[model samples]
Target: MRFSKSLIILALGVSLAACSDSDNNDVEVKPPVVVTPTSYEFTVTITNLTAAQPFSPVALIAHTEGMLWQIGNSASEALERMAEGGDNSQLLTVDFATHAQSAESPLPPGEQLTLTLTTEQLESLKISLATMLVNTNDAFTGLNAIDVSSLAVNESLSRHSHAYDAGTETNSEAHGTIPGPADSGEGFNESRDDINSVAMHPGVVSQDDGLRSSVLTSQHKFDNPVAQIIITRTQ
Candidate 1:
């Protein structure tokens, strides 16, 4: 009887040890987790300060390098398209721009428009915007690649922008060349008929002033600081 009991006890001990070994072998080893970088964002607000001139839908770009237009330099074909005709499709798709956006409609006098853009990083970040003054011939207002890398989230700054002539088209202010409602004429002519370098705009000479053939009147005239731009970092 004693011998039979010893055999039973030894068998039970072996079974328990085998179950313990199996439990140890089945322990789980999880793989490491992966993480992604957060996005940085900015918001831009543009207000037309002109009394009569309306601004075309703005082209807004967030880029690491490159500019929309540079003073004394020849205007790019994309810029000429916007300045001459208020078309911004090409400017938004430039190679150096990482993110771009456009306003939905023309910003009328005294009105404002806001837009937002986002990216993964902020090193060497710049903001550039361009919009045509619909009442003028190839005149535009915007920032040329303003460096905003030092701008902190929730911070803001304002710039009172002056007008610039694309110099691709003459400021003829003729009956059929003005694109605004004053003339409702042609826009974006491909010919580089004027001095082919960008420069500060000379105020428009309307028919009321001296240009007899001018389709524009004194009401369409504007001076420096045609637009007020405010930039804010949101995230």
Candidate 2:
């Protein structure tokens, strides 16, 4: 009977040892996890350089490398809409543009306006800015598809924006065709009036300069480099 008791005790000891070893072998192991952060932001300040020509609400876009208006290519319908009427809604809704904003109101000559934008990545960020020359037909000014990916935080850059003639309208300087206060005429007519491709603007010749039909005065005449834009990366 004592031998039987000893045998039972031995069996229990073996079972307990097996359970402890199994428990140790069943332990779980896991690796650390990592995540990447996203986002880039910046600001643009625009200063009008013309004597009297007010700029329409400026449209600024941060896109993933795409042209808004090529110098020799035809302007898109969205560009045509904004270029003719100073309306930026359609331009901001373009497919390639990831972020966009428009200035609050007309930027008068000699005045300054600023805007801000953000995007998920900055490696290939391209910027496009545009505004109508309120005193001329189809005349617009601003930079197009400028690469800003290399700009570092708090770094700054500045460039003069030359005027461009949106080939959508004629430079007739006619009374009823002007959209600004000088004439209070129409904006964004569907008809294609001028050359169907983009080109540098030819300065306006106002009524004071013997263009009797032109509603603008000597104050509205302008030359190249109509405005200056400054960009500063904030993030």
The TM-score obtained by model 2 is 0.85
Give the whole-model CA lDDT for all candidates, comma-separated: 0.92, 0.88
Q: What stretches of model 2 exceed 4 Å from their correct place?
A: 1-36
Q: For candidate 1, lDDT tens digit of each residue in 5-43? A: 999999999998888778887775647676668788888
Q: Where does candidate 1 clash, by residue pair? A: none
Model 2 clash tally, residue pairs: 0
All models, RMSD in angstroms: 14.6, 14.2
Tell how far residue 193 is off in model 2, in angstroms. Answer: 1.8
